[model samples]
Target: MAYYKTNKDGDGCCSHSDGKEHSNEHIYEVHGHDKNEHYGESCGGSGTCRCEDTHKEDGVRHNGANASSKCGCGTGHGRSACGCGCEENFGSLKQTAFQFGTAAVFFILGILFAFIFYDIKLFNFLNLKLSSVFFLASWTAAGYKVLFTSFKNILRGKIFDENFLMSIATIGAFCLGEWSEGAAVMLFYNLGELVQNSAVEKSRKSIIGLMDLRPEFARIYNPEDLNGEKLINPESVKIGTLICIKPGEKIPLDGIITEGSADLDTSSMTGESLPRAVKPGDEVLAGFVNLTGVIIVKTERDVQNTAAAKMLRLIENAQNRKAKVERFITAFAKVYTPIVTAAAVLISVIPPILNSLIFSAPLNGFESFSPWISRGLVFLVISCPCAFVISVPLGYFGGIGGAAKKGILIKGADYVDALSKAGAVVLDKTGTLTNGVLSVQKIIPSKGASDTGMITAEQKEVLTYVLVAEAHSGHPIANAIRKYASENLSGTEYEEFKKADIQNYSEIAGKGISGLYKGKPLFAGTESFVSDNLNGGISRSENSLSGTRVYAAFDGKYLGCIVLSDTVKTDSEDAVKELQALGVKRIEMLTGDNEVSAKEIAEKLKIRYSANLLPHEKVERFETISSEIKAENKNNTVIFAGDGINDAPVLARADAGIAMGGVGSDAAIEAADVVLMNDNPVLIAEAVKLSRFTRKIVWENIGLAFFIKIGFLGLGAFGIADMWGAVFADVGVALLAVFNSLRAAKCRKA
Candidate 1:
């Protein structure tokens, strides 16, 4: 497809489609010197001319309202649009209206509550003639809606729902002559449900927002007998077909740069805030924004199997997984509800039956015992588990959304709970802690070699010729070498080389690349890559100092070496020190590189322990560390910080895995229990602190509930507290517990 040079909206020029009413004079314009024009006409007989005065030709255009269906879009002069117009937006007017409806429900319930607790019994005094029947009827209407909804789900073979629990509890209240209390409980619960419901909707919105990263379609050029060119979808755009991407548009597929260069905003993929410059021959990822310049990229893969979509699919799957705590909660609730219901029944009936044998019991007081029996029913009503059932999941929902605001995403509540006990940490050196981009530190022309002396002409020919030959390969090291020449050495004549004619060329996937240039075996790679390719008659420095090592070899001999280094993340060293201070006994560095490079990185980060290991080797190392921690100290824990991709298995294996979620792999983000979204490693400390805070809050809520229940029940058993106070012990404590538990929902990372 033919890409447009610029958008008309941006240029403010009247197109042929705009009609003659807006002429070139009336329309505002800004232009530059047209290089293709004649010097006399364009520059006005001089070296400069006003670009705004350049006139344009206008003609009739095809009659179509939208620019998409006709003109350059449908006619193959551009890309096909995949526009939703509504981006990952969670805030909208409809959402505001929903909140208002929730407020109305709470306001009405609040007023009804005031009437119940008042001395005049304002609304109740009017119901004086209606008696308890009117109270029962009011509750029946409200309570039965929940009852029917649960019944419908049950008939459809669904059970253990929170709705079922509330239905049963409200029915028990009506049977106990606590009709007013039952209605009020349902009213308040509905208010809490409204809040919980809103949170769940927001979480769903968070996930949906991520899906917008995937492109729906791409416009392709189709040559046919009837039409010279036509627009097509990315699915039909085959490999090697040139795809065009315009400014402010997402690239439809992954490909190597065949033509053009621009600053690409790839924050959508790598989460780096800066725009990365991409020129011809550089690899461009799918879903990156072309900020400027028109780039024509050849499709390297089909749209369906693009890495961007795969990453989104991984995130979706992670949300379905459950943590150990979540699984236990599910099983515990299943049995706890049934056992308590049976106990409540025995409490109401058994004591009354046993009292029949006592002769000393007052005959006049026998009637009063009925109200006490009814008090037991009110306890059962409040214990419907509605708050516990709904609020627990709601807390986790809020936690994930809060974390996303800070760019951290934990898959589930199980991860949030598991992060509290991070004991050990593991790291991958390059790309994790260090900026993956590297620059050359030194260009050793070789020992005892200088301009016009020290080395023979044969050696000079080999050095200059080999460097240019290797640079032809278009690898990362080659680019760094090219950049070095562009900066320091510019006067030397450069030989144009091609890959197809190069003899004996070979590529190693995980290591590096090498080939023949002018029949001499030329090579460039890490110390290991160069060492393996040469017999090493000339010894090279095998030990890497400061950072990573790169080398060059020719004709089974070590020629020269280049040292490249990546800058460490700003907070990496301090975060490591903080974790060690927190009593983390073991800190390991795992990588796909050799021992020397890994050790160098570990020393810089001040990590006490280290492991230079492979992808699978890291997993084995984590297993040993976790077991050793448990053996030495019962409370010892193991934590791992890694890229979410290759280290995914190890991430899922550890006691706690904290992914550099913003800078690392998607696989690690999905696998780890905790995520450091801001690329600040100090978040590891913050997460541990927050996890401990949440656990403390949970225990506080539970303890407070138990203390109030035991004290108030003891008072009622001895006739010190009235039935009204007993009800407060149940309802009042519950509201307090729910509110207190929300403190755990706070995400410090956000």
Candidate 2:
């Protein structure tokens, strides 16, 4: 006896009398079971076998008094069992090829018979000719699927599709004694459909191949049992678990390295070809390949929350968000088809009736109405809306896929349209245009006014107090101050400052932060913020500093200031120039720094500036700029790029938001429509150029399809074109438009 069950490893296997688990490759030999019994239900039906067998047979069959079976073991099976020798069941592609070949042979024979034996009679019923017999056979073989589908659609209240149009047109051709043209129409249409399907499949494969970064399994690290590391599904791993990644293996989850270091290839995540060297303390995201050394990473997030998973989800959902042009084409097809079908019906009846009355001819026989009905059939064939319906959304899908290859994740086709029309670009001062890393440039002590060579005693006190107050803050400026203190202060002094008790901590947005230390008020913020609360205000200097200055005050006495500077990114100036060269009319910068510092950076890039603005003020400024640009041209849009949490509101309020995914906060990324995987400001310009290219290709397809279709529609209506010409107008135009839309997938770099 043989029985099946799921093993501990979740594999479906069967146990025989030998007490050994046999895989599904071995056939089960059943004894004394009735041939008509439904054994598939006990074995989980056809094709649902968890053993991953190829057989999909549902029931047992007896061959020479012996019954053989293949089962799903416990799952819901789908198809027939393997090695069943079922030659009659062929796939759709094979069936289509066979039918087309047979039709082509019959069609050629019919044309030959018409030329040599035109008067030969094949049958007595209705005086069918020899050529007509072959023609009827060719038509049946070529058009059976179309006729069947048309009938089924009519029953379902769907009478205005390509199948219905083609079926009616070809059948009318046969009734009018145009037998050769009728068969040729169906044959050519099927050929065009085959070419279109091939092109669409190629485009889909090329686009989806760019994102092949999913890791198969993760190795659980076991230091105590180093030789026994088990490989399991990445989704099964929990947070804080230690996972080992060997060289040439993909990092399966977002984590921080705890043991060894390696050179990581982050091209799949960031689209940068250079390999980044990572140390033990460096953070790593999922989908990066380890290049050199083995590293044990402590997973920080579950598999679903990794960056790769989120990116895949974004791409999968992108098709659901349609562009305005795509939506218009879809809606137009729905209204256009029924109207054209109605027009074909009127053309068939009215023209014959009017001729009979005006010329005093009888319209009782098929001969009197044949010419007008043939014209109506031509009209019906030319009226198919396949070209516009298939190619419009396909163009947008190719555009999204092209942008994704460059590591720029656009949320939808609507955003692609918005990016192409960018008129004014508003960039945040830090992280967007300038590197957000800040370093202490200079220190000034109020007590020693002339000490420029070395740090004085009062400067040390100021640095220590600033470090103590800003230790718990997570802002970038606070983190910079802490780093500076750690490197400058001695061990004893750093430890003493870290141990100082503090209470009543408060952080005022965009200005500064304050806390009470040892029952004394301490402040580390802008010069004006510190000077306002002090008993004696500091002296105002006419010479403004080049970088941001954070003033320190304690116990109603001013200590000094620390000037921290952030360098502009190497690609910022080039990116700005490229945007201008691309015909962007306005480029501006928004910052919370002092006007002097903001102006210095803005002048270097030669753009306008708005300084001393809070988060809400930044949004208001963006709105004003957007309105001004739209007033000039309503199609113009404003885009904002930022990386900090405070920039989230402005990022959401702009016409299009671009987030620097490398150093940007979660809130900023969540609010943005486009995300640049790396902190390269040049990517913004690249994205604009790509969007324009994609839009141009889409419009080109639309123009080509409309021009060809409209010209043929007029020709067919006036009897200048035949059914063969109508088939070319409908199917030929669709194939050409589809080929043109494929160019959007191969976007050139700007």
Best by TM-score: 2
Model 2 CA deviation exceeding 4 Å by range: 1-156, 177-180, 191-196, 448-454, 662-665
lDDT (Cα atoms) of all candidates against the true structure = 0.55, 0.76
Highest lDDT model number: 2
Off by over 4 Å in 1: 1-141, 149-165, 202-319, 358-369, 443-545, 551-553, 577-585, 592-601, 609-624, 634-637, 644-649, 656-750
How well is each residue in 583-609 modelled by candidate 1, as lDDT tens digits?
Answer: 667777776655665666678887754
Worst 10 residues of 1 by lDDT: 67-76
Provide TM-scores for the models: 0.67, 0.84
- Residue 667 lDDT in candidate 1: 72
